[model samples]
Target: MRLSEYQVRFRTRDLLAISGPDDFILGEGRAVDSSRMFEPDVSPYCFDLANRSLVCVSTADISGATFFYQAQRQYARTVIKVPFESLPDGPASPALIFSIGRCGSTLLVRTLEAAGMRAVSEPDFYRQAACHRPLDISL
Candidate 1:
């Protein structure tokens, strides 16, 4: 759902508990809610491997036309930290798209989405992984 469609209120402690350890937590998170962590719109915005934690923020409605970083910062109030070990095992095989700059990759992704395929455009997690060379986790 689009972030604007719903009021983004800070969840209450009881609600957080009911949402489960993998869904919500009080204050800064020590572990990520695995379900929300994997959503298409949730981007792993920061990583602190030494601390074994990463921060995720929602990016709903972000598209090729949007300024990614600017929009992310505005929508970052819901950010939460997740420990490395809390991350679930990835799919045995995952599909990916790669292209050089100005190659219409974004257009291709948009087209695919129009055809009912789920795709994320230049996700921050991918960029983070690329910049943070020699990552312990396999890409």
Candidate 2:
């Protein structure tokens, strides 16, 4: 899909769109997730102002866009699945809110999300990282 001008602007301001090591894991199809590999250096979410959605584009793509280099996403690119072991540990959150059931934690997260912060509510990665284990497809 051709990126809109607004999307370009959003990407320009995205803190996570930086060139570095392989911090992403390509899934079965077109899905990909940031492993928080470059923790504390960059965030994992790209705040899309136009769509109000969080999107993750490859760092190479961001580089291309920044430097005016032409590299199409649909071209013959190496899509690699970064191993879980390669992912670096995420940084400790500066602020964490704990609560019982039906608490406002979700609201807080959503509010942060709306303000262009990379906030997640009860992310599965927390459990996976806590156990120091990768995900099992069978489970």
lDDT, candidate 1, 66-107, per-residue tens = 335445544545665566777777789989888776888778
Highest TM-score scorer: 1
Tens digits of lDDT, candidate 2, 72-135: 1222122322333434555686666555547676577667768878654543223323443324
TM-score against truth, every candidate: 0.61, 0.31
Off by over 4 Å in 2: 1-81, 88-95, 128-139
The Cα error of candidate 2 at residue 92, in Å, is 6.4
Q: Give me the runs in candidate 1 sitting further than 4 Å from their true place.
A: 1-33, 38-41, 64-70, 133-139
lDDT of candidate 1 at residue 10, scale 0 to 100: 45
Give the TM-score (vs. native) of candidate 2.
0.31
Candidate 1 global CA lDDT score:
0.54
